[model samples]
Target: MTEQRQDPILIVGGGMAGALLALLLRHHGASAVTLVESHPLTLPDEPPLTPSFDARSTALSAGTLSVLDELGLAEAIREHAAAIDTVHVSRRSRLGITRLRASEEGVPALGAVVENRWLGFVLLRALYADAAIQVLAPERLSAIRRLADGYEATLESGRTLTTPLLIAADGAKSRTREWLGVSARDSDTGHDAMIANLSLASDHQGIAYERFLNDGPLALLPLPDRRFGLVWTGPRDQVDAWMEMESGALLKQLQQQCPAEAPRITGIGERQRYPLILTHACAQAVPFGVVVGNAAHTLHPVAGQGFNLTVRDLVQLACTVGGASAPGKLSLLQQYVQRREQDQALISQASRWVPEMFRVQQPLFAHSRQLGLVAMDILPGLRQGFARRAMGL
Candidate 1:
């Protein structure tokens, strides 16, 4: 390979997806990578600590964990993580309930939960330690112009660099996607997700719960220290009211909402809310640039599938680009997107459809859902298939 083959593959937006992509590229034998983040990047001796009750978290599906393990990052992440051995899903005020156990699935755990800060810390630490990677933080993309063979990009600091490939992992509302003339189609789910960490009276026992109520889905993901990360989605007014309630009142309301099998909620922490929207980029690859992560698709959090899907996309992208003579070749990029179409489409559709399916108030829909849940629980093959999909396998 000539020096040109090692030319920096510029990546904009050094958040979780961008940072992870840089490392995955290197892991796939890409020699040079550049990561750009508008926010300052630093590696503190210790991961930033948040009050146990206040930190937000993400559940890493089993397949995602395997990818990280291949990158040699799982050990450090496991230190601050919580294992999810079982997932119990049910509908409130309904007779249907089902549990997916890692034991049945023959995996160590269905997934793991880690605070967002810690995950970022692990990714950034690895990126910073890699001599083959270049970090350009506290900087933003000013402009990008496409050339016949590559792209020339200017940073906010007025520095110019050229690369055959540019990646947009900026986020759901990615400006880079816009600069590349890619548009996103966003569908409002007519609900807001209120998130908080709950102090459980008893341990979570490695169980995560997804309970569908009259309003929306309530996801309780186990976190370390006997706390559960809560994502309660409902009407805006309801979420606002719950956000304003005193801790005791909020805990009582949560207790009422949760299943009888759920752990007791002793306290609730700082609350944050965001509207639920399903966003999909009209195109994932354009010329010298390709979109990934939230930039490519932002799914409903009902299934905790967004980041896990992004990880799979990044892994596929690394494999595709690593084997190409020209990383930004339009044909290669298109091939990558085409190969990922089925998985991405399935997961994205399921994420949007799950809440909508449960939201149907008709008696017929209700009975069908009950039958479906019951069938899934009683049938080993059906339950295993559902479990595998949820695990991002």
Candidate 2:
């Protein structure tokens, strides 16, 4: 029998959450950590250019920015992110439009939109710069065993690592969760989101727009180079049809849908599609393992809060671990769970409920949503609260 050996905290999935958590842990003086990713760390040649933009982008809220700032990554992120000063929410059939301005909340910008790949690059840069954190790319976890003092993980390369804590940030389809016997409840909403980048004829002026149509929500987020990132959600069939349409035809349809901004639309970039699924793990932490990011809770991208929420998860987990004598000990892990459960539950419930409420065809619910937007516009406290929450403050 192979003898057990002590290993650093094991982080599965080298995506945003995993990378950020590793950085934060190192920043907080927790040096012994290892991050494993299935994909290679090196950027690909030609970088997969298409009309479809990155499959994911995140709006970094003020609180999240501060968290990154503390970790010394804000400057790096800002160098590549596009600042958004306002958000406009409207209905396609109605004239009702609600605008949220950063000035109203006393912030220089509402948030920043950044491509997922770029963010990954920045995180990898930071991790490499840190001596305490070791990242293993192109390696995947193949098995996990829980022991009295810690956990042991066997990677696909036939190597075994023993650590007291395991963090699962492998995203919605996390293999680590399954290996650990963690069950997740997932609901397929029968919707898919089509995302793309477009060169607009006019500048977005740092405004993010969300339009609710009879189908689903369509959002236009500002990006660099006079380009805008779009997330269009609708029924599976409709989304599939849109995906099948010729680039020119789809551009025309987009122009019609976004009349105020159509003139700015010019060339389309790589287009991608993702099926929407709402997934929540039964628990965030167990004896020696914990789930984070999409692995913990996956929500509709309509509100653009999915990644933001994941960042918050990392923040909370960091705090809990930092406060402990040994970062991954079982007692500390329990405290982590206790501290994060309420917030996670609240967000998950709200995400699930809000979409259903808006998806309803009932006139009363529509009126309520419209009214809620208006209320958010006029109520300073309410808007500030939301902004703060979104920022992960």
Candidate 3:
């Protein structure tokens, strides 16, 4: 096949991570970036008849907020997001709150809770608004080949293009990663997470709660209205039962499971379920490519850190490539991997271990878990340090 040369960086997957990275690169004066998305660009004409819901919602840490501010997407997000001023963490059977207060961290808000779709819309808006960026939606990648100086990709529509760099943000099942021969290990947690939207009787008051039950972690995140985003993890059979319940019954069950003094579930919205899986790529960077977002690491949604971690990957990559004359150079890619290797390892390890900490039936293990929470609460310096590290500050 004849080779078709291109002048811009090529990004596969127009999801949050890819769109954000494209915007960041454009902001840093990297022109001619092209994003290819398998999904169509137009928004669905009809909203959910019951309640609008997204499978995921991201908790933007303070440092993440700063990064978004630099990218000019912060204001757009703030305009649509719910500011979480407090995080209340506790055991399901216990009555005491373990962590609280955003003020203690010297930030106006601990984080912002925004629907995954809203974030995507904002990024798409920014991407389309930029004249230097080109987006191809409803397009699929068929194959990729490494060239002498760059890479060449073929679209399902029989179009071929070449660029210096190929970014794989397609997701955990990334085709680019597979084509490039990157290996990843997958772990099945034998659990599933059910996410939905519900309107509570009482206002959430911008509070985010993580209730650790014997089954798994249950999160209720405040949304724009009196509604809250719910992420509940448990055994597959149990989650299947919950998903099968009627709207009213499901709401009642949720209210009982959650510790907040919320009234009966007034309304229930769209509900969806996904199997929980933890996956980590053997390597995050290659000679002419790198994988970000779910493609790089897929974590349990218990901590709401999956997307946030992916965004952090983009931030680190941008910082590494900003000053380079050739961003796709082997030396630059190696440096990017070195700079982000530790942080990625730390997050992956911590995410894998934290859930295990709560699985212990022994008294000593339970006591240690409680003590760890207490330490995180009382030690302002430690909490602040964690917050900073998460934000990639």
* lDDT of the candidates, in the order given: 0.89, 0.78, 0.78
Off by over 4 Å in 1: 1-5, 46-54
lDDT of 3 at 179: 83
Off by over 4 Å in 2: 1-6, 43-55, 259-263
lDDT: worst 10-residue window of model 3: 45-54
Highest lDDT: give the candidate number. Answer: 1
List the pairs of residues colliding in candidate 3: none
Candidate 2 per-residue lDDT, tens place, 1-393, comes to 994434577899887788888988767656478999887776432221111123566777777777888988888888878998888877776545667788987888878988877777777777877776887878988888878866888999999988878889898889898877889999998999998988987778898888877788888888877888899988999998998999999998988888374346888888888998888888777777888888989988876887777777787788777435556666777777787777777777776676666677888878888888778778878877866666566
* lDDT value for model 3: 0.78
Better TM-score candidate (1, 3): 1
Instruction: Write model 3 residue lDDT over 177-260, tens digit each, in one string.
Output: 888789888899999999888787777888888888888888888888787888889999999999899887777777788875
Could you say which candidate leads in TM-score? Answer: 1
Q: After superposition, how far is residue 324 of candidate 3 from its true place, in Å?
A: 2.8
TM-score of 2: 0.92
